[model samples]
Target: MSKLLGLGIAATGLAHFAAPAAFEPVTKLAFADDIRNWTYRNGATELAIGLAIAAAPTRKAGFAGLAVYAAWLGKRVLARR
Candidate 1:
């Protein structure tokens, strides 16, 4: 489960760097016209989180971080709706 979640998050993080435009809509929610920069930042963040989660030594902290991150993102997305 940890591996799966970590891989999923990492994959999306890579996507952010590989195709930042794909995240413009979500990034636009907070960054407005500066979506690209925010996308890269978010990608880096996700990559770190994913790596932490994948590593046995940091799984606990990673899950906690992911919980907070997920809630924050959910709130933002919901607020937009």
Candidate 2:
């Protein structure tokens, strides 16, 4: 009974956390030189992969996704400087 209760709570927590940000609003920025714009192009990809990992059920897949994301971020950071 305790195990089932724990599982239910954990599952509910995960579901709420995994839910899309319902209150956030998207706005268009007009600046062309904004570094965020460039970062968005690069970081968006890694962010997606990280989310994919976070949502993955298996540890191996999640870790693999994290590794890929780290490598990608490292490459970008090194390239900038």
Candidate 3:
């Protein structure tokens, strides 16, 4: 399960790198002029977290990934307000 989840996350990161332009709109509101760069950085961060989860495949790793994801989600939610 962890491996699958990790792979999914990694795939998403790869998608960001593959088509940063497509993601630009999602971030344009927050990063008007730097959306592309921001997307790339986000992709890199996601890739690292995905790799970490994949390498450990332990409860700790899963929790760590979840925490990071939750933090990201919280940040996005807060930004909307």
Candidate 4:
């Protein structure tokens, strides 16, 4: 389960790097003209988190990734307000 989730995350991250333009629509609303830059940065973060989870499929690593993602989501939510 952990490996599957990690692979999914990693794949998405790789997509961000490989086809950043495809993600423009989603990111454009948040970053505007800096969509490319934002995508790349986000991709790197996602890749790292995914790799971490894959490398260590432990409860601690899972929680760490979840916490990071939750924090990011929280920030986005707060920013929208």
TM-score of each: 0.81, 0.36, 0.72, 0.75
By lDDT: ranked, best first: 1, 4, 3, 2
| Alpha-carbon lDDT, every model | 0.84, 0.42, 0.73, 0.74
lDDT of 1 by residue, 26-73 (tens): 788855556798899889889888988988899888888889987887
Runs off by more than 4 Å, candidate 4: 57-59
Put down candidate 3 lDDT per residue, 3-76, tens digits, no spaces.
67776777778889999888788766555556788788777867767766676645477568769776875687
**What are the per-model numbers of colliding residue pairs?**
0, 0, 0, 0
Query: Model 1: runs farther than 4 Å from truth?
Result: 75-81
lDDT of 2: 0.42
lDDT of 4 by residue, 1-81 (tens): 777777777788899989998977766655555679988977877777777776664546755876877587567646765
lDDT digits (tens) for residues 1-81 of candidate 2: 433433443443343335423211110122224444443443344344444444435435545755775576566556555
Return whichever of 3 and 4 wins on TM-score. Answer: 4
Winning model by lDDT: 1
